[model samples]
Target: MIIYLLLAIIIGYLVFVAIRIGLHQRLPLALGPISLELIPDRAAKKYRERPIFTIDIPCHWEIEALKTRYIDPLAWSAKRIQSTAGMLASLLQHQFNLQYGERVAIFKQNHFDIHLFTISIIRAGGIACPVNGKLSINDFDPYLANLSATILITDSAAILKFLQSGIDFGCCRKLIIAEKRALKSEIEVTALEEQMARSYPDIQIYWLEEALLSVQKESPAVPRGKDDPLYLVHSSGTTGFPKAVILKNGPQAHAVRGWLCYVHLSRTWDKGFGALPNNHQAVILSFNSLLLLGFPAHWSSSYDHLDFNAEEVMRALADGKFTGYFGFPVTYTQLKEVPAEKYDLSAMRIWGSTADASHEVIQRKFVSIGNAFKAFGIPLKGSIFLDAQGSSEVGTPSVIRYFTRYTNTFDRRIGRIGSTPFGPKIRIVKENGEKVKRGEVGKLEVKGKTVFAGYWNNPALTYQAIHGNWFFTGDVVRLNKDGHLIQLDRLVDVIHTSDGEVYSLPIEEKLHKHPAVFDVCVYAHQQPDGTYLPSVAAALKVKNSISNSLLLHEFNQMLEGKEKLCRCEIMEWSEFPIGVTGKTLKRVFRNRSEQMMK
Candidate 1:
């Protein structure tokens, strides 16, 4: 009897050990050649189970709802997003034969369907590559070739552009036409699937709308480990062809964390509005950050981005319903032109800018607009502006600093964009890897959770950008006495003259302070003598006139000794042409100035 009892005790002990081992054991999940570890939710777990996208999921505006003048009538609830994404994953994997690490290039703007498509691609273990719809067919050709995409999903506008150009979809095996439901009537909608099937007999074409509703298969998200590549985002090819950057899952998650930390989002504030393009990483990462945050923010409607409607956005802000607002500096430049007292913009508590720094004049104007409704005697409250200096590789802003009406101080300095984001450490380093002293200029480098993995298929460029774990941001910055980082210019933007190196941004930012100057870009022009002259082209405020001679004279007086320049041109703000992304084409202006001056 004693022997039997001892044997039973030993068996029970062995069973306990087996159960413990099983709990800790990790399995590697493989989709084709890519292998990922599905770790138990402990750290860096993004959007596992929470409300992500907000609204009715099967989001078609009812015939009655569509009659309303709401710019973007579609909203998607979280469960609807999941089920639609799951169905999409199944269809993409089974029908299109998409595998791990394969590129699926999508040409689209900001819309709920595009967001759903992106989630589906990642859930199906494929890289979602969103092409900038603003790029011309000639500019877009290399990206398609470089991607070697197995699938191409595009909108009607892109298709129309392709038809107008010599570029062909020879590289893509399958095509998806995602017609914008809201803008279908604006363009001449066609039955292109049938026409394309007839012309390209070898390739398959499918309509995105039909598939979303018809595909019944379910494939839930496979937990890809945090470090795996999730997206392939292209760089703005101002200097040359765009480099496709590999966005890793870990950094993608970090973007959500960084934004949450930077802007203290309130659970009560349910709606946030941003008019970013579909390709922007901030918009892409927001779809996943739903793990911690309660509700998803809404994107602006699928209207022509180049022709931005100020009223469409201002009306939304003035309605006093939204909790947050995000836009580019250029957008704010246009917004400040509208009278602040005309609208009730006080409801927007959290406001931020992503691309370029808001001109100090516009910065002060936004704070004033936020505080306009406060009683004349009472102090202002609940308005924050973020000068988020960011890029495609940094996941979110590498530098994030805020200015409130109560906290802001006037300091005449160049590149006062912001400071470090939540998880990254920003350092000003010299070429030799030494940290720069305060008040000295150096290259900006970032080390953190959100730095990108590398440039897609371009290891040489990747190596040049990242040293060890630190990614070298090509931006030039200096540390102020208060330890705040000031953006000077892009390394490429600085030009060397016979006198010395001249940073154009400082010259331009200083000039912008002049009452008559509304907007300006500074570039270097080379003369027949081979000496580079720092030059300025400025846009004058409406009804304010300044002559080119007087402008040059005033500009030269602002500079001392070696910093003085020989040329300046003053024109109306509308005269300065912008790129499709709405950035001033400084290189183009420099070339034109070179021709004119020479």
Candidate 2:
């Protein structure tokens, strides 16, 4: 009887509340920031708009304004991206029997065609897996097993290498070759293709050119929802080859569209510039946003073009080539190394760099770099440099700090990365999963509209990565009282010595501030006692007459009396091996440590 009375009381309260809300004329339901009007639906259901499907999402924005060209080897606009995508989709479905949700690995470099080819995979409702273009046959073996991808699409050289190696990639059933450049000897290419077909008779091979030219559009798109997986990108393998992580359609598009809206990429923005490889997440974010928002893509470079010099970039811009620029630290730093008077950079706006933070010299050079931009106001600048902090998994940036080279009040400390970008709620948490107070050092966790779904086909790793809705970024950071973020080091990179935990970043940051130091890498060296000691490996701007011992002695003065564990050593740039992303790998230091002793 008491239970019935309580139930009746709750029901009456709900009914009263509902009646009052129903009678109100101006009451709008608010969920977060979006407001919804709770109006009664009419009896005619047929008059309502048709349900939207993920497949209905535009494969290509069909915006001719969005163009890409390559300057080094030279290519022009990618015409009819939509029709070409449809044709490629037809080929993938009919020729290779590509099913929706199946994986196709694209082993290619950064190119305009790669984007179109990837878009085709999307239209076919297949997961587009693009690995590092620099991966050799040996590297491909492990990735092949990891991806278990049914189809492998690559250039002529890669396929030939795999065939010549005589390694059976058991998982892949088909090979699709895209030989855009016809410079390779026709007979040699033909012989290799023939040999590949014979060696791997089980794996059927086809050409992307044939698909584009011959295939007629049949069935349109594979039915998929917005929540379905879109692109399978890699984590930034600053340490090693990163795992394949999945980015979904619904959340990705939602997040990307919002970011585009915030950036406001209009016609006035003009041609944007970026040299990020197609495999890099920044490339994905850039092209996808530009194309989707009807903004133009960057000019395409030829297939044979390996790299760009600072002079080439400056001359291009000086010739009224591009309006916007997005470059990595090394690219911008090259421009910085040369005198600013060497090039005319006045046409450029929205200049920025990501991937890695700038060194002290690079930052100073950036100040020198911004001096060329003549257009600006009190609050605005002729040109701004975005020294941003973000990774592959997170599509949108977490922190972005802009710099005007002309500012008088500017502090040139590169320690502070910046505040958060659009999308993603970031929290600094303790090991116990509790949020750390401001000015406290803790682990970084993120969750938002743009965060990746999880690592591809690795449930155990995925489980470890994501806790509930928040993804553990594995970076250890400190939030200062000013709301700026300072990256100490990666959680795994944090060395635990007798001093408890020693962050390499602070030491690196300090050493980098030294006049002679250009760049440095810090790693924990295992002593004979089995206790690890922090070791600093530095590359200097120039070789001085001072001996190595004196240099070490001078550098060690910075770490004096604080921690007995750290030892400073300066090495030539050639000796300190850098990875593809330009990070000094700890593994290389470890591998050569014994050699160094000898």
Candidate 3:
């Protein structure tokens, strides 16, 4: 009897050890041929059960993870994300036949699957091509054809739209539908599936859930050189068709390291939040930064595919111990309407803005909201607003500034040029490549490892973009007496009036300071007499009693010389031509303004 009891005790002890080992097992992640085992940080053990990333979808939105799979898809722990992405990578490699150097086009909305799928693609040795999911079928068809991607990963809305449009699948032989719910439409999922199968009879169709459930051992990561293309990110296409920008393997690592040098990382306990569009370069790079730093972040989707509610964003930020909030300037413009007293924003340490330089008025409002630092263990009541001036071509921020509540500055100064070990070097030069004097606006050119490899499949255009070692940023800027770079305007958006060249941004900045103005777009509009003149379209605050004539007079008073506004149109925010990344499409607006004259 004693021997039997001892044997039972030994077996139980062995079982306990096995369970502990399984619990503490590290997950493997592959970047190129370099395999990295995600070792659990001892200090981060306290946060093991805590959510490292969250996706807060509105109740109205029908997402598969929210409706079917998980009870709480909000809390995606690090282990879960790593393990799932590893599995998905295996599925892509073995099941989907995704080979090294092949492009996997992600044409989905702002869903949680996007992050997983992107990571999986990297692990599987495929080039990730994230397209703007909000584009119409007519607009997106040619882009897919150009990429020649082997796999197309999208959601239900895309499938429904494709069926209606009857566009070919390009070179995409395999389709993986991540979500089954047809958002903003009455089409049934089954009907759409049938239609997709019928339309593309030769192509393979796979559901994301099936891929997730299937078991496959992780494949060996394919080797990649430093110059090998990592991902293909696209330009905003405000100028023309979206050009794919090739982001290479090694330079991206250097770029991330460069970002870490200046950008303040979040503390272990401090959660960050963002509502920026998933496909934007800002979001892609920032998310990568968060993962590398092991910082917790919650990314809320822009439900309407346009913009998120300011109240909802603030509510999410306030509910948790959040330290950061990030979005486009348009979201910040709307956030200005949300009163400070409505939410507890004291926990916020960093309010980050990118995609475009944020307005001074909007920056000041956010800077006054959260704490910059604690005063003797007591939380202070003001935050640091970080405005990072960059674009897809730059790949990383060229200039950055941290605006604290203590500093009351003027003008639309973006920041001083940033520096890192292998970062970008900026120079303001004339049309003939002559260096400009201080306070003289010239074309901005950048030279460094931080610039994107080149525009994909467009050798001629790529050659045109680069001059010697420098890449033209297509922006006009000047250096102030204080050695700060003040952004003037986009080269294309510069108003060539009868008097002289007028910058749109400075005038837009001036208009944004007014109490009644909510949003403003300043551009060169062709008048009836066939001359270009500085014009303005602005949206006013709710219940604003000011008339358009009165506001126009006030705005013009703030401007001087050639920059004076000739035409002012007060329109709803929705009426303005907005780009996918929430940038005001000035050229499109120029065409519309001309049409309005007729």
Q: Of the candidates shown, which would achieve the greatest TM-score relative to the real structure?
A: 3
Task: Report the CA-based lDDT of candidate 1 relative to the real structure.
Answer: 0.65
Candidate 1 residues 112-231, lDDT tens each? 566667777888888888876777688687778888888988776676676557466757878777643554653344455445555666777666655555455667676687787878
lDDT of 2 by residue, 1-598 (tens): 9999999988887665444323121121111121000000110121222211011013211212222321222222223445445567777888788888888888865455666667778778788888767655676677777887898888776776787787667599888777533545778767877797688778877665554555555335565576788688777566666788888776665545444533422333355666656666666666555543334435433111136566666676667545566677656545554565777765555666777755545554555443223332234335656666667677667666666666443222222432443457788899998888878988878788778888877899889888888887777888777666777787767776766787777776566666676667887776655556778777777776455576667767777443333566767756766545545677666545535554
The 0-to-1 C-alpha lDDT of every candidate, in the order given, reads 0.65, 0.60, 0.73
Q: Estimate each model's TM-score.
A: 0.81, 0.79, 0.87
Clashes of each: 1, 7, 2
Candidate with the larger TM-score of 2 and 3: 3
What is the full ranking by lDDT, best candidate first?
3, 1, 2
Clashing residue pairs, candidate 1? 400-419
RMSD over all Cα atoms, model 3: 10.4
Cα deviation in Å at residue 256, candidate 3?
1.4
Query: What lDDT is reached at residue 111 by model 1?
Result: 53
Q: Among these predicted structures, which one has the highest lDDT?
A: 3
